[model samples]
Target: MTTILHIDSSARPGRSGEQAHGSHTRRLTARFIERYRQFDSRTEVIYRDVGAVPPSPVTGGWVHAAFTPPAAREPWMVEALAQSDALVDEVLAADIIVAGVPMYNFGPPAQFKAWLDNIVRVGRTFGFDRSRAGEPYWPLLADAGKQLVILSSRGDYGYGPGQRLEGINHVEGSVRSVFRYLGVTHAYDAAVEYDEFGDERLLRSLADAESATDRIAQVIASVRTRRHAA
Candidate 1:
């Protein structure tokens, strides 16, 4: 069975507009998974909701425990270290990852940032080899053979060849670049622009999400087929 890691990172549960936007992404991803499952009953989907509540930032103790050898760790260090290890394992076990990341202000929410910090560890997702000079840091998550699909919602960010709000689209680039650094070569983004929060705009956004769901399903099927063929 192929495993997929599904993640959602919008802060609002049912209160804010951003939450509403993320809900659309969540539904779309679910639909995509359902479509994928129809063809492959053996596929397993694992979920993580960082938006349920704010996630804690990695602390000094977490850093120490994460970097230290497990055999020499104290009891208090065990829990934090274990959490990080489990998160890493989840990422490693997945053949595909679908994540919903809403734009907050100009970037992702703090919970998403916290989630990223937990999974992106030195010597795990990346490494620094002293033997190398200019290229001291190297990627270590290369063997996972995973693909990432990102769904994002933004406000007032128009898309075009020469859009004035080009800077606001940095979130997409950031997600792609960081995941690439972790050796995720196949990363794709699907975004719905909810710049206007009117009822008409909302409906349009939902329709776009429906289309995106179908698109994702096709992508998933194609990738799984290629994997099996290989």
Candidate 2:
């Protein structure tokens, strides 16, 4: 059975109509999950809400433990790396990953960054080979052939290719870069923009984003079906 890792990094919580309004990305991710379940009932989902309960940031000791060889590591090192190990295991087991990311100050939120720090570890997701003259940093996790779907919610518009705010839009680009480094090449994004401008533009953007989510869900379902058959 295909295993999907669903992660939501939106800080907002509660219902959309509530005083503590939920984020657009959270709603979009829910829509995607609903459609995905309709496509395949047998699929298994592993959900992680980083925004609600963010992982601890990597510390100096954590770094030392990660760099140390497993065989030579002490019990303390092993304990220090337990969380990161679990996070990497989840990714390695997943065939697909769906992440809900809300842009915060032109970049990903602290919760998402903390998760990234936990997952990207030496001798785990990636490997370094100094003997290989060039291109020493090789990704070990690339062989999994996983697909990544990102649901992004932005307050402003023009963040796409050749757009006015493209240069400043670091959230999407940084996400792509980090995943690409870990061997995830098939990445897709659906974004809801013009959120700060609460008007017809916001409504239109939400509609378009919902449609994009539907399309992505369909594509993922089709590919999964084909892979399973093969």
Candidate 3:
């Protein structure tokens, strides 16, 4: 059975009027997961919440431990390596990955970025080799065989012509590039836009979110069916 990893990176709790972007993304993710699980309960699902309170960025100790051979690692290094290894292992095990991310200051939040940095490692998720020169790059994540779907929340970014927040494209582009760099070539992203607008616009955004969730469910089901057929 294929493994799916679901991640929520929203810091807010339910029913808050302040309404963070990640909140809507999280709701959409939950609905998608419920539908996915109903279709295949036997498939493994791994759920993680980085927005609830994510881990800190990797430190010097972590860097040293990650480079060191496991047998030679000191106790302190072992502890640091354990935290990063567990997260990286989850990514390695997953066949499909789903992430709920909200744009903060034109990019992903610190919490979510921290998780990304932890999982992406040199000689782990990817590597560089001088042998091929122009294309000397190699991927350590190739064996994981994973695809990705990202649910993004943005305020006032239409992803179309002449939007003031057009720069928001960085969010999607960055995610796509990073995932592809890690050997996930088949990745897709869906977005829920305009949360900062007042009541009417917020309601519209929610409606868009609901529609996106439905579409995501359909896509997931179709992909699973195709995989099963193969």
Using TM-score as the measure, which candidate wins? Answer: 2
Superposition TM-score, candidate 3 onto the true structure? 0.85
Q: What digit string (tens of lDDT, one per residue) describes model 3 on residues 43-109?
A: 7889888988697798988888877777888999889877678888899889889888878887887
C-alpha local distance difference test of each model: 0.75, 0.88, 0.76
What RMSD does model 1 have? 3.0
Show model 1 residue runs off by greater than 4 Å.
14-22, 159-162
The TM-score-based order of candidates, best leading, equals: 2, 1, 3
- The residue pairs found clashing in candidate 2 are none
Summarize candidate 1's per-residue lDDT along 1-230 as a digit string, tens digits.
88989888866454233465335556656666777787778899888888885447899999988777667889988887676777788888898888778777767778878888888887788886779979988777777778888877766546422777776666777777888888888876766666466567766876776687677767777778888899
User: Model 1 TM-score?
Assistant: 0.86
Worst 10 residues of 1 by lDDT: 13-22
- Residue pairs clashing in model 1 are 156-195
Point out the higher-scoring one by lDDT: 1 or 2: 2
Question: For model 3, which pairs clash?
Answer: none
- As for TM-score, the candidate ahead, 2 or 3, is 2
For candidate 1, the lDDT comes to 0.75
RMSD after Cα superposition, model 2: 1.4
